[model samples]
Target: MTEFQTQIQAATRIVQTVYGLSVEWQPIPGEVEVVQACIGGREELPIYLTQSGEQTLCICYLWHDDEIEPSRRTELLEAMLDLNIPMPLSAFARVEGYFVVFGALARQSRPEDLAQELAALSENALEALEAFADYLKQ
Candidate 1:
């Protein structure tokens, strides 16, 4: 198996055992090497893990463009920026049509570390939704 695949497997086990969370591996339609981990109870915020030569990324999609209130877009962006630094181990980002919260670690990080990242990203996703609720369409 590829290094990332190995990492994903190990991390999935750790996340389940350590955090008491279920993890489902999903394949992206066209991306052969990319898989997403859907955490139980937080299925709305699936975490996508990707690896490069130097680092691994853990990202959770938070909201889509159409989900945001048109007039509050700027304010939402500003709030995200303000919260970025205060948030632990995660930061806000825009990926194509979605807004996301993500964290990164060394490519060689331990499975425990990866599990921790998954937990943090999951928590951050929920917090982001709560924090930005006013800027979203009801």
Candidate 2:
């Protein structure tokens, strides 16, 4: 499996316990977080947020790989439709190889799902995730 696919699988097992929802990854939904033009691409990670032709939240990622050539963020954004990620996938950053990715799980999973998952935790986990979300401005 590719590094990302493996990371995703491993992340799923970890989040199932920490996030409380049982997520099953599926194809990227056509309507959810539509992949607008690529704002950028990187060998590390391309994380960008933009509005649709109608103002809305859309995100795009250009996977980090050694074999790819560098290109302008705008060029990447224009070609983004070809690099759609499953809408519900967790967004994580690996700093020094340790990750902090979580949430947006299961393209169809709702905030309520996360809320319910929080309900199962022993108060502290709930607060921790909440604090993190707060940091994300969610």
Which candidate ranks first by lDDT, i.e. highest? Answer: 1
Candidate 2, residues 1-138, lDDT tens digits: the string is 433334344544554565554544333335533221211112122222222343322222322332123444334333332322331333333334332323233433343443332222213222323433322211
Q: What lDDT does each candidate get?
A: 0.89, 0.32
Prediction RMSDs, each to the true structure: 1.5, 17.1
TM-scores of the models, in the order given: 0.91, 0.23
Highest-scoring model, TM-score: 1
The global Cα lDDT (0 to 1) of model 2 is: 0.32
How well does candidate 2 score on lDDT at residue 6? 43
Q: What tens digits encode model 1's per-residue C-alpha lDDT throughout 1-138?
A: 677888889989999998999999876655445778999988878898888668898888888999999999999999999999999999988999999999999989999999899988898899999999999999
